[model samples]
Target chain A: MWHELARPEIWVPWLLGMAFGILVGSTPGLTATMAVAILLPVTFHLPAMAGLAVILGVSFTAIFAGDIPATLLRIPGTPASAAATLDAYELQRQGHGAPVLLTNLFCSAIGGLVGVGLLALLAPQLARWALRFSSFEYFWLGVFGLSLSAVLTPGQAWKGMAAAALGVLASTVGWDEVAAVERYTWGRTELFGGLGFIPAMIGLFGLAEVFRSASHRLARRPDARLEIRSASSRALRTVLAHPRLILQSSLLGTLIGALPGAGADVAAWVSYGLAKRLSRRAQQFGQGCWEGVVAPTSANNAAVAGAWIPALVFGIPGDAVTAIVVGAMLMYNIRPGPNLFHENIHQLHLLLAIAFLTQLFLIPAGMIGILGFRLFIRLPHSLVMSAVVVFCVVGAYAIEQKWFHVMVMFGFGLLGLWFDRHQVPVAPFILGMILQPILELNLRQGLIKSDGRFQAAWERPESLVLMILTLAMILGPAMWHVVRRIVAGIARPRTSESSP
Target chain B: MFSAHPARTDETAAPGSNRGARGGVSEPTWKALEWTVVGCAVALTAWLAGGGRSALVLSPGDPGPWLVPWSAAAILAVLAIGSGIAGLVGRRSVGAPREQETPARPAGRWIVVLLSAGYIVVAPVIGFGVATVVFVVSFLKTTSQRWRWWSAVVAAVALTLYVVVLFEKLLQVPLPRGSIGW
Candidate 1:
């Protein structure tokens, strides 16, 4: 594995791909999927190893570079980086920019290595486990993810849920996947397939950030200056201190990523939530806690590696990136699935090497991305904000080359602004939109299969577990409050009688 | 609608918190915004419930397509109304107003919104390259009055060239070239 990486043919395309990934990924709205797709034709004629190198490099490095904007600005470059906007940006606000990013870089590499290692060792078993999930389990899983986002968002739980509900409604705009009918298109051709996620995401995170910066510029609040400098110190000590956290988050990320439809974004959020709940300084989580940065950054990149497990074993794409990758693999006549292990074992080994080496390459690639972003932001704040607005426009337009998407971006930008003012966290809204299809389709399908008897869900053990977890996540706090009140009332009466 | 929660003013809200007086657009009329959202949610719920129930696809066992839409819209309406009512009652209970807190500036914000809207309207007509250059220069001058014209033009042209090379030349992803073309 080590010697294969030493070959110039192997390393050259890989490095070039990493550079491209950093450029595309750090820019809001130009997702990793688009980058890989755009590069697909170029890779068609290249050697198989070289083609794999470009795709794998972009996929891995993009997940890491996404943390750049999420930490430096409140905007996340990709959906996977959304978790970073919570704690990483807060830490950056608190002037811990250098150490926070450095730690993020280191942890991402380690977490990715751990994920690749696990993928190499346990592909078959994990693939089987993930494949066992049915429509019923999928519904419960989506609910659980939604419930987690609601609780994790910093606001009134009801408000978070409201935002999530609004998001789900927004997602219902296109075709009804099961029924083959439109719900909210209102006859616009652009609304047929639905609002694209990338445009809406940039509108919310990118354009919304620009709008805030404009407000701050007018308000004369000079609080939006770049904080990328002041140090270029090592974060090795901090990383060393959190060995257990790095391991745990990586493992958790891998497990979640192995689940079909549960992508890196969900893994990051789940890991961040778990870390906050277990930490001694839980109260300081959203208020500039470093563990918050580490957990999500580590998990997101790890999930990128874990996403390849099902892609390799079952030929089912674990996420969008892998779908494109598996498609590319087919073009190369190196098919995915169980037979590939027997016939193309060497090709599998090549993928393993690329995944492992990609982590090592993240250090240089991430630094360049960070420095480039710093230089960009170091421009005059108001100019930078204006430039970001233009970038958002271009990014939105680039998707399918449609002007309607630009309109969608602008509309969502306004909605994001409105939501921000109302203290509705946009994170849950985005998650809700992403998960709505899975939630709605599976829910109806499960109901249909069970003849509308909801009680039948309890028959499947996995479904029961997931349903229970989802219920607990949504209602646990309120029930806990009721239990505490009952216990207090009983104790108060006993004390009063004893005193008399 | 503009009543204040004197004890817990928007400025006093915790950072990353649900509370606080948000500056900017919502400051003047959050009640209307909240109620508007609630109204929209309510209308959506009614539409989904009424239509889906009457539709033939909703068989005895299957919930059909509108189940999620109705449920989600209903929940949103309920939650938004509750939140709006709480906000209203909190304002009314305060009685006397305290010293007013400064809202986040909306002057530049309005300019940004206008500029963005203008860009969207004009870009397809004028093409991405020309439109981008014009947008950047106008945005810079409007936002930063003291800035030099030459520098702004230089920056605008540079950004245009960069994007043209990126989207058009390198990535081969075309941008809007309008009727006359760039």
Candidate 2:
């Protein structure tokens, strides 16, 4: 893997990825999808590995850097990194920029390493197992993924279910997955195939953020200036002192990463949740807490690495970002799946080596970013925000050269803005959108395999376990809430009497 | 509308007061208006869904694209209903105005909205390149670059060139060419 690092073809992707990563990461509306989309035309001229290198590299770094503005300013750069706001901005206010950026870089690197390691280890086994999966299993897998999303997003569970239902319904547009008969497409040829993911992503994540950003006429709070009073060594020591926290988070990140379709935001939230529950100083979490910073920062980065395993081993993109990577791989005539490792072992090693090296650059790159944040942050929010909106529009249009995609982006952007105002979570919506098609495709296939018997979902132990987990995911939260309410009710009289 | 608890003057302080007292309506009045808007939205969603499946389809399809549209309509209906309910609930609980804080409105809001609307309106007519150049320049002028007229011009020129040169020239992504020539 190390030997492949110096190859010129490797550097082509590396440079391209780094430049695009910085651009997309810096921009609010231009997501990794749009970045890769604009660059997709560029990939036509390059080899598969080199192309994949550029896209995946951008995907990884862009996602990492997306948190910068979110931390420095209140704007969440990417939908996936929005979770950073709860603690990151607070840390910035507390003058923890040096530590926060250092932790982000360190944790991201560690998480990526962990993710790559897991991808190397688990993807082949999962792929082999996936081959045994019928349509029924796929359906269950889809359900399981959605259920986990609902379980993970930090808000009303019903809202998540609502978002997931909407996504499933959206996927049901155009045609039925099995019969290939047109279903909800209306008369539009674009609808004949259903809503494209890139437009939807750009709309939901990009255009929506643009509109929402417009609502906030951001004033230059003099504090928006990037101030790093401490050194990197101090930040490094603080993170190292929390070894247990870091290890737990890295593992959590890897696990979330491995989950098909679950992205870094989800990973961060899950790790944050765990970190809060397990920490001795759990109450301090929203108030410049480093563990709060470490959990999501590490997990999300790791999730990026984790996303690759399924894409490489099973040919199923774990997330939208990796879908681009998978697409690049296919362009090279190098098919994904277990055979990919054996057939193009050198390329796989090269890719792995590149992933490893991106982390090493983090120290220098991140330092430059920290120093530049003041100047970058000072750019008029109106102009930057407008650019973001344009990027989203152009990006959606570029996805398929259709106006409908742009429309979808705007529609979703409005919806996202509304949800933000109402405190309804957006995470589930993203998960639902990502997982719905997989669920629908799998469910129908599974049903066909099982001769329309629902019981077939339980026939396989793995499927059954996944189903149970889904149910548990739903019922556990409800049960806990009910129990808490009941207990509180029971204690009300006693507490009132004692207080009086 | 349930008016069990009348809004006090201070509860009305939220939105209008937050806007520095020039806001047209009292805080309580705005809250009521917000409720009405939410109620109207719900009614609209229900109305949209009232028709048969074909009526639901925004596009049209075999088996009808109404399935998802109807689903979205239903969700939106529910959300609207919930918003109205929450507004009423907020009114009841606080007995005063329930404070719903929005982000401080910057002067840039109107400019941005207008600019964006203009961009969308002009993009197809003038082509992306031309429309984009105007939009970027106007945007920079409206925002932080008052003394730096050249900065706006430079940014607009540079951005257009960068996108055109990169996507069109090198990447060959087929950007919209203006009818007015290069």
Candidate 3:
């Protein structure tokens, strides 16, 4: 790994790839997945190590760069960054854009390093543990993730649950995963596959913000500028104070990302929710809290590394980006899974080295992206809003080359505006949408496997543990309050009787 | 069917004093909307459960596709109704609008919504590029006091071209070409 790091050939392509990724990830419609796909052919021409380096560089850089738009505008450059948008946007509105961006950049690098370190040390062990997880366990895990939304949301939990339910309902618009039945298409050909996630996301965050800004009577303050030098040190100190949060979020992200289907997006949401639940400043989460920004920023980048675990260990693609990397590896005659480690030890070392170096390269690449986008943030509000609208339109339309997707984007934008006005948190809805299919699929499968007996889910040790955790997460707070009241009642009588 | 605004304690306050009730929908109206949504979800789930084209028995006693959706709908229905009733009763007991914290200006929101809708509706008839230019110009002119029509047009055109070139030409991701073509 050290020997490989010394080579100039590796460093040049890695930096170039990171630079390109920053551009793609900062754009509203162009996703990390799309960036990797576009760069796939280019990677094919390079050597195996160089190709792997490119993929690693792009994936990590893109994930970090996503926070740029998410901070400056309310629009998330990638789905994973959506969890950060609420806090990032609020912070940006408060003229803390530079500090927030710096925090995000710093956390991303640290989280990426942590994830790679864990991958190097624990891939096989964790993969073995993950193998014990059955559909029943997965069902409970999904429910647990969903339960965090209620805890994470401010004000009314009921509203958050309602929004989540609505998201689940929206997710069920296409063909059923289990029965192969067309569930809720409403007779449109495009509806056969369900609402496109990218289009819907783009509409909810990107176009909705445009609508919001356009509707505001007061023009944006023209003097607002990105002040990085003064803010970076303070931001770094703030982030450093939350070492426990950074570590926990990174580990959790890696675990979730190691799941074959659940990727950085899910990891980010779950981590953000968990951070809010555990934070002393939970109330400040959606109102521009630095902790809120750090949690998701760290988790998303960590998940990028975590996604590689399954791909390298079990020949399973952890997410869409890894799936492409797997394809690229196959083209290079480098097979994944256990045999590859024994046969091609050098390749494995190279991959681990590339992951580390890619994260290290993020320091410079992220600064560049932040400084470059900072200039754009100084544009007048009218021009910025108009450009955002155009980007939203183009982004939605580019999804499947169908006008209907754009229509879906428009509809969701309207829904987002309504949600915003009504004080219904949008994050829960997104979390529910992401988790719904996984939950439904697993639940139905568990039921079938159990022969309609609910007890069968509890028969497996992992499933039973997950079930207990889910129950505890749901009922613990209420039970704790009740117990506290009872104890207080007993103490009050004694204290009153003995009063001097 | 429920008023979102409780009877105003300050009669002297302006007509649009309540910022809490968005779009001027009263408290009861919002609650009724929640109830309506819950009812529709329950009905949809019940309909799906009853009407099945194909039934598969994974095991001798297994319920098929309807089970998950039905269970979810049941949970949602219960929660929604519970919340709705709680909110309604709570509002009735405290039957007064809170002091207005901010003045409502709904005109801008409606204007933008309408402009966006028009842009969506007109894009297929006129080309995407042309519709975007028109929408941008109209939106800037409406929202900004010092709006310049020519600059707005130039900016809109340039932005549209940037999108087309980046997405359509460079990335080869086909964008919407309306009936008017390029």
Candidate 4:
């Protein structure tokens, strides 16, 4: 593992990946998916490790960088990084120094290292355990993933479930993955498959925001000029002070990332949740607490490193970015999966080394970003919003030649605006839309394979544990409320009856 | 159907619960918005159920696309009920409106809504770039800009390049050129 960390062949590609990640991550509509897709054309020419390194670098950087605009502006750079909106911006608003940004970068780097360490130490065991997840287990896993979102979202669990249902509905709008039956495209040939994730993301998060902004068009302009004043040395020390949080978030991130389809977003959210729960200063979290920045930032970047664990060991692409990298590998005639590790150990080790080194480029790029935030913020909202609108139109058109994507983008923009107006959490909707299909497809196929025995899901302990976690997720908050109510009732004075 | 004070006391400040009831004028608008959301959720749920792989399920059907959305609708329904009951019981407590000291100069809130709605309707027809520039310029003018003509020209040129070069050339995604034949 240490030997893989010292190779020069890895450094070059890693830097390239860092640059790609920061650039894509900085932009609003261009997600990690588009970043990976854009790099695919270029990556095809590189050596195997080099190619995978670039993709991985881009993926991690983009995921972390997505927080840039989300914090600086209210625009989320990527769908997965949306949760950063609440806490990150709040911190920025309160005038926390630039040390927070540097700390986030430092923690991200540390988290990446920790996640990589976990992959190196634990992926083999996890992969072996994962082998037991047959179709039935996978189906349960899918349901559990969707349910987990509901659990994490605040408010009525039923509402979260409803958002999940809406997401599942959104997913079903495209073609059925296995049988190719048209689910709900409404007769357009484009409907033959279903909604593309990229376009939907652009429309929902990007254009929807445009419409929402249009409503308050002439209200007080946002504070675009943000100045951060923290030295790197001081920021680094502050991050070190919170070693426990760093350790916990990194470990949580790796665990979430190692799960086949759960990506950095889930890991980050989970890490944020854990950090909030564990912190003595939890109330200060969304108000720009230092821990708020550290938790999600670390978990997401760590998840990026952890993503490769599943991708490398099991030949399963961890998330959309890894999935694209897998496609690039197939283009080179290199098959991924369990056998690839044995067949391509030297190559895999080289790629791992490159993944580690990508942090070098990420640090400098992140520093530059911290310095540049002020300038970026000064740019007028009209100009920024106009550019965003242009990006949405082009991005929609690029999804396919069809003009219908524009309609889709606009349509979802309205839906997204509606969702925002009501203060419903859009995270579940995105999570459900992204994860439900994977869960459903795997389950339906598993059930078909198993001949209708629902109990088959419990055969795999991993599946069983996840299922239990999902149940706990639903029950935990409700239980808390119930317990709180009971305690309050008990604490009430008996004299209330006499007084009344 | 229980009612509470219109203004919440300090003792009742729970973390995850709604605060004291809003004023009567605002209450109905919020309630209307809540029910509107529920209506959309239910409509979406029905559409999902109608298009399900298996439609023979009970009222508590399979956890398809509809199930989640329908559940959201149910939650909203609960909120709506709570709001309605609050509105009814707090009718007597509905505080009188504060009198304005002078003749009011309207802030043009409806015009803002109309302008946004108009922008959306015009976007596809005029092309995003053109429509966006026009909207921005018109918005600035409506909000009391002195240099409307200059703003319009500058915004148009800048937005066109943004749409053409950045989006079309660099990203290689096409946008509607325009229905006006531009």
Error of 1 at A134 (Å): 3.0
Identify the runs in model 3 with alpha carbons over 4 angstroms from their true place.
Answer: A1-108, A119-124, A217-358, B1-62, B91-105
Model 4, B90: alpha-carbon shift in Å?
12
Give the docking tier of candidate 2: incorrect
Docking class of 4: incorrect
CAPRI tier for the interface of model 3: incorrect
By lDDT, highest first, what's the ranking?
A: 1, 3, 2, 4
Question: Candidate 1 on A1-500: residue-level lDDT in tens?
Answer: 66877788778878988988887677654466656654554555457888899888898788877877677655576778899878877777666666677778888899899999999999756545656777777677667767666765555676678777877888888777566677777788789888866677768766776665565432111123323333334367778778888899999998777764467888999999999999999999888887888899889888888878867875655565775576568768986766666677777887898888889988878877766665543456566666667777877777677889889989888987776555566756776776687678778788888888877666799989988887887789889989999999999999999995
TM-score of each: 0.71, 0.75, 0.69, 0.67
Candidate 4 at residue A127, lDDT? 52
Error of 3 at A83 (Å): 14
Q: Candidate 4, A179: how far from true, in Å?
A: 5.7
lDDT of 2 by residue, A385-497 (tens): 65666666666666456667767666666666656544455555655555555555555455555565768768888788778877888689769979999999999988999
- Supply the DockQ value of model 1: 0.25
Give the per-residue lDDT of model 4 (tens digit) for A1-500.
65544456655766756775776577665577656654554454456666677777787788777877666555667765666666766766655445555677788888888987777677667656656566555556556655665655544455456566666667666555454345555667876666765556666666666555543432222334323343566577879789999999988988887664567888888888999999999998888777887888888888877767756654555655665565466666776555555676766666656666666567887766655544554555555554555556555665555667666666776777666545555556665665555566566555555664556656567768767876777677779889999988876765576685
The clash count of every prediction, one per candidate, is: 3, 15, 9, 8
How far residue A352's Cα lies from its native spot in candidate 1, in Å, is 6.4
lDDT of 1: 0.73
